[model samples]
Target chain A: MTDALKPGATIGILGGGQLGRMLSVAASRLGFKTHIFDPGANPPAGQVADQVTTAGYEDSAALLAFANAVDVVTYEFENIPTAALDIIESHGPIRPSREALRISQDRLTEKTFLQSLDLHIAPFADITDAASLEAALAEIGTPAILKTRRFGYDGKGQARIMSPDQADEALNAMAGAPSVLEGFVNFSHEVSVIAARGITGEVACYDPGENVHRDGILHTTTVPARLSASQRMDAVLLAAKVLNALDYVGVLGVELFVTPQGLVVNEIAPRVHNSGHWTQNGCAVDQFEQHIRAVAGWPLGDGQRHSDVVMENLIGDDMDRLPELAKERDCALHLYGKAEAKPGRKMAHVNRITRPQK
Target chain B: MTDALKPGATIGILGGGQLGRMLSVAASRLGFKTHIFDPGANPPAGQVADQVTTAGYEDSAALLAFANAVDVVTYEFENIPTAALDIIESHGPIRPSREALRISQDRLTEKTFLQSLDLHIAPFADITDAASLEAALAEIGTPAILKTRRFGYDGKGQARIMSPDQADEALNAMAGAPSVLEGFVNFSHEVSVIAARGITGEVACYDPGENVHRDGILHTTTVPARLSASQRMDAVLLAAKVLNALDYVGVLGVELFVTPQGLVVNEIAPRVHNSGHWTQNGCAVDQFEQHIRAVAGWPLGDGQRHSDVVMENLIGDDMDRLPELAKERDCALHLYGKAEAKPGRKMAHVNRITRPQK
Candidate 1:
């Protein structure tokens, strides 16, 4: 509004994984310094960040110091502790708002919020105990997933029920935490809209990308998604509706199911999403930069993609293919400098420019 | 020949200015960490680098320590002191080779090296004193430039002569340093090839970019430069010739003059050049990443240009236009977080995607 944060302004980030690492690089590209706060030592983001605080979220003094040093605060992941937000928010502004985090952090709350906007979502019910779980399963039927309401990602903290008989095991997987029962939607495939809203209430949405998951992990995302003009419009419009409804001031990822009847909402992530990584090569401004621009109050890029790209994640042993991938034509690699190649860990991603769609 | 530097490998970089800053970001994208060695405190590159050794190049102990900490060493500036390079090279390999640096650090050596490669270069003579300057003037004639043999950049350490009578003033401009006298080429415009050579002898050259200067500093570099198809091939071939001749293992900038007869060599930079910044948006693999790949013993990118881009530098007061530029469509900004906007200091650059060429 009043001239975006000046070039030297420092941005405080709450998580220091691959997302935080990328956000740090993006901040630098725009002349903004980033100070990363994470409990882990030698966080991936710390390698590229201007400053880093290796302290837990419960360390209020560290949180306060970090907030004081940065002009504004944003985050890489949505599961930030409420108390940490309270401490940091007291010193400086946090983009995307605490309200956005509150909703996305809990599955029940997110689905309810989306439904309130008249957006179609998978039928879901809350579960508090054994009886509640049984009742929800009875109503939602089999072929459902039971997920913990919070602290879940990359298919963690969830269990699938093939039939009503498996409801007990699924509920047990929750470990007695409050949960949500989501009846599987009959959808052809999954797609996601990476969207952003600026401080001036203007919204921009990148074209939806078709997603393919392997073993509950994102395998690849291809732009020029298989979508009719109406489907693309629906995806972008619904993403904008969610952004405006939350008064969001940063990028968000909205995953959807391309069902036979219409598009159905799967979930929303309040920060840059892995599904949007193709934008690093496909668009003039990537999701990380767009998030930084919105949080800094700069004008959003028009979100017009210049190239068609296929982004494939390099998980764990995929690092073995570095030699082959490096030799491949038109492949731009974005590797997270994680030391260990533990199974299922995301080591890097490669975005191959297929061609310019235009 | 072998695998590229592993993701967690550290790359030691000399000269922590904007070039090192960009190189650091590119290394991070490939999952490598960078340690910057700069004399200045809080260098722009330090903000993004994993480590910073704020020690002057003359500090042999610091230079040795920096080199010992990384897998290999590379530099951002060509004017590194011979003693400092000796210290670092004794500890680890220095890419682009010490020979490449030796040739490029001095204007006289660079010209001689290019001529040895059978490349077309401007007529030049080494100048050590008034007699030599006068003799060179007689041979080269008026409208020539006298440039210091070493440590000159951005048109500094040079003086122009329009007539023979101005010889004394031009010689005095050198202030007793070794100098070179060059006859100005009657050319139409300037263009540069951003070229790279891998450790295994593979070479890649980006399409030549037309360069326009303002106050003797690069103003903008536009890809798809005005060149006949044959001229374009000449540019790339000559660039590859230079790279292979030097056994270069990193990116080089080869400036050329478009003349009525043919393309003439203007100058060569052993490291990344400001004129090549357009490749960041125009090519699948940018010059920075290409340089890293070369030095790390990786295969070279195909150097394919997907979009037409114009890269404009933001010098000093040009930072004032950030607000306006931020709002422009297809504009991708890369800003250096220098605290003060000193006159002539390069503060940032913007790459505007003109359109896809194919």
Candidate 2:
């Protein structure tokens, strides 16, 4: 049984970062070897995986060689170059499908898809120029945020138009890239639903966790979040519906805006998200394992929460506290091997878990 | 502060096996590189570790190069060859110290050391030959187990001697190796205490987990084990006492046999033990992260268990069940990428978590 696919099965990972590193670790735990493909020098994921392929996403020869070496392909980030996916898909199975990738890569398409499904999302309008910006601004209103439809992450590629006077500057900041202007949600708190779907159409969801952000980056996520039981149920149901609609495979993180009105969908990340880090410490199945199971065409395990959990990011230089942190009776500390501690970069995270109330 | 130790910081691993593979994963998580010194060609640890040095225990030149390349040294097994330790110590730090490894390599020495520290161990005696085996049998009676003095794992290097007539066969079975004759323990249950001590001597412990074994190999470990609060305290205290007495650094596993009378020291694993797998799925601070913390000279994190948990291993053909296991909502499955699944060999494991009663 092992000879056909017993763990030495190489899994090709696209993009190299902390998420990929964690995923490689999860895959290795289940007997699968990971082959990391990333252009970045010394990708964090490359440090631990069985092999590393350092080539640009545009290199077809490198992509084909990587694909030939793996049984299946998965990714950590969504903004992967389309050419890379094309070459890899030509050689191996790609989870969640290229359609999911294309749709998620474009905000305009994502919003349209959600609206078509009759799902809840903030009101939005596309802007191509000064006329489009002025028209979209009038329709979506002031105090709205302007975001490029592609390549946005960790507070990058977006600016807020607090008033009409700043709209021109915001529009010029994008340098003429197609953009979307969205009205802000008046939500009391932020939360995320991390769910995984298998190729067999099986779907599994973690209990939604309340997330707190600082300077537009996730700071912490706490499980058994302060939500009514009905609210939690509603969140899970909405996430399952989205995964079903996309015919998705692998882990998908749905960031939600919880308002007095109810749970409204904000955005969906086709890959793992920071908000799900609590699973690493709080549940039997961390997001990394869940994603591997989904893409491996294996049956999913129980995602039940056994305790109240809190996961906090250790950004920048806070990694210095690892010694003291390690002394705690129940703490899980993970540090990404990023050499540079630039401001706003996520360095690591710690999860503090408590016994679930009986 | 990670800059203090660049990406190539050489990590020295003592024992070479799957545990080393997992530790290599954790080390890569923090950007530290590792050099594994193992004598076997097919070491599970070497498959993933960055570098491998295959040489005899007494190979001085190989040991010198290994020490010179590594910034710090850690190990995977307790029974490291004493000569190997002498060589590593001459070049760099040999974690857990030679004394700990020397004492732990022999059952009688370990028991004696425990007794000297006011700790308790199962009744045991040193058996040098057939005559000594007869004497031990006469004194300790039938059903006593004889184990080799060093280099034993799983069910290897141990035999249960039940009849006086079988003394010669048992001694022969030991291959003339120095052995320990241990009286069978009348235990109600089995458990383990996993903890880490940093270079600064700060220690952290996860809650003890009840363990079950089949064929002398670990089967499952469940957290929030059925033990009184005081009993848990005793387990932690016992582990700390052993660590301090040995002046051990890095991760250690102290297995205990739980009996009606009280706790008895089963054995001490100088490195990470299989029983600590529950931490990977059910606790915030897992054993792998803690080991990394100790070796990195960094502060330790909290080792809290957040869920009531069950960890099940994948043996031989069990790797085929991974897809099904992934569909469970909170199942954490780990497969060690062994190329072969020969009978009784560890292939992988899964963890299932139950939420606390709210």
Candidate 3:
């Protein structure tokens, strides 16, 4: 609490994609230089950063140099290995703590953490073996989602059970590894809260964003979601509770399933989330800046929305709408300079602003 | 029109400061690199650009080398030396054509240009030596501002006249250079329109910003300015008129005086401006990116406000608010990474968002 991040201090970032690219922009805006360490030779974040280290995550020598160069360390994506965390944590401080990642990375552990908080969660059970898979499927019933315990995103490494007979197929598909069976909930909508907790334990949460996903990829996020006041409050409280519980010191996104009863925790991202992209044009300080502030030992920014916004992710050929989108009276378009707009690729995004009558 | 600007294209910035620094950031964002040809090294824009050429405005060799390296050149300021532009035009296409700069670079010429378009302007007269100054003073009269014909900003290089004797001092203070004696129209408020004209002659304007200045330095700009519907339309149309007149292919700021009669043209900046800082948070495509797109022969973006915003310039001691500003809910603070915040120096700015209530 006694230390304030000084200008010229370098922030070391793990993972180098568009999120990292934007985080570097935010870090530099606050007079903090960023050093990016990504195994990829040409990570997007490296383009505008002060320096970049293109070495393997397991290369302890390069990791040490990166940690030594930066005053603080953080990551854009949560999938970084535990060994990579250990290597960096042994040197500079890593915000959002490893405990947070350890919990969020595992479906069973994440569900358990949510249940302990007396929060609503998707009905789920751990499946360690074929027998347990059958029992869990019998209990949760058909049309249940069977997901690997770790390393899953964008619909990867996961399968769904439409009937009891499909349980064996799903478990065998995971190659007999640990899994989680989630009972499908007839939720009304999907929403997410992107919040941050500072080093001093101050927490701030942005308003919930209504998210729509297509083909397991986020398609759009509209802010000031059409949620009841109670639902919004519950979502913010859940995000803050997660941050405080984990002793997190950076921005995190809590995805929630909104049902007729209330909000249920889906998953937590211990980093900036794509759903918060609307903040780039709708809020005062964007989620990227908020993350930078929290990890830099600076105060968390006010996470208030200034305008009703709709952020649409430009996947693949959706990028062709740049001209069409930009011509929309108040639409904001952002195109990441990815070489190819292959199918299912996240090439860019568009944010459309509308005035909510006061 | 089908050709997109390539990397290594020269972006000819007229003024070397933080706006240029941030503009350089936007240029690199799209993979189109910039070569800043500011007269000095270590300019804020120079810090992040691919290359910087240091030379006087009159140096043809340096200008030619800079122009030859890039496909097209775009300026960051309007008052570029005519001699310098002469050389650059010989080597590369200068977007926002030099005609735009010529009209904007001087107060008298700008007023005349606007008048030619049937646009309203502050009543003004040109002054060269003592006799003309006396007659021009009588026409424009006392209680008006006496501004140098060239090189003025943030209240510098100008003098105020209140009486007959003060006129002599004001004239002498300008070092006997040509000047513009303008009648100070008592106005209720001031604002600016930041807009872009694409290569195809399309125009897009961001919402006008109500501007306030202190000690000649811009202090704050609030979006969705307190102007009548007619005034807003007039301001935007006037800006488009200026852009069309120049065949301008870049972003420009047109400052206006909201007098009792109507919105009158005040001044024009042939590049990104301090008053339009709100775009960084309030709009999807910031003024900088719009400038990049226009100069690159790309379609112009939607220059619309996503939220009501107040942009306050962090000048000198004001920069110390970084800590609190960061913590303040819903305030997006942007700092220029300046090593020192010297008096009258622009260190950064903060945009506070005020979203319309649903």
Best by lDDT: 1
State the lDDT of candidate 2 residue by residue for A16-51, as single tens digits: 799988888778776777889999888878777778
- B1-358, model 3: which lDDT tens digit per residue? 3576643344656545787778877876555556778887656666455567778788888888888887788877777888888888887788878788787778888888889988888788888878887898788777888899788888887898888688889988999778988888888889999988888888999889999999888898988889889888888788888888787888999888888888888888888888888887766678888898898887777675656778999888887666667657667777776778899998988877776532
- CA shift of A21, model 3, Å: 1.6
- What lDDT score is found at residue A119 in candidate 3? 82
Model 1 docking tier (incorrect/acceptable/medium/high): high
TM-score of 3: 0.89
2 or 3: which has the higher DockQ? 2
Per-residue lDDT tens digits for candidate 3, residues A50-163, read 678999988989998999888999998887888988989999798878898888889889999989988888899988888888888778788899999998899887998898
Number of the candidate with higher TM-score, 2 or 3: 2
Classified by CAPRI criteria, candidate 3 counts as acceptable
Residue A351 in candidate 3, Cα distance off native in Å: 1.7
Top candidate by TM-score: 1
Per-prediction DockQ scores?
0.81, 0.54, 0.41
Give DockQ: model 2: 0.54
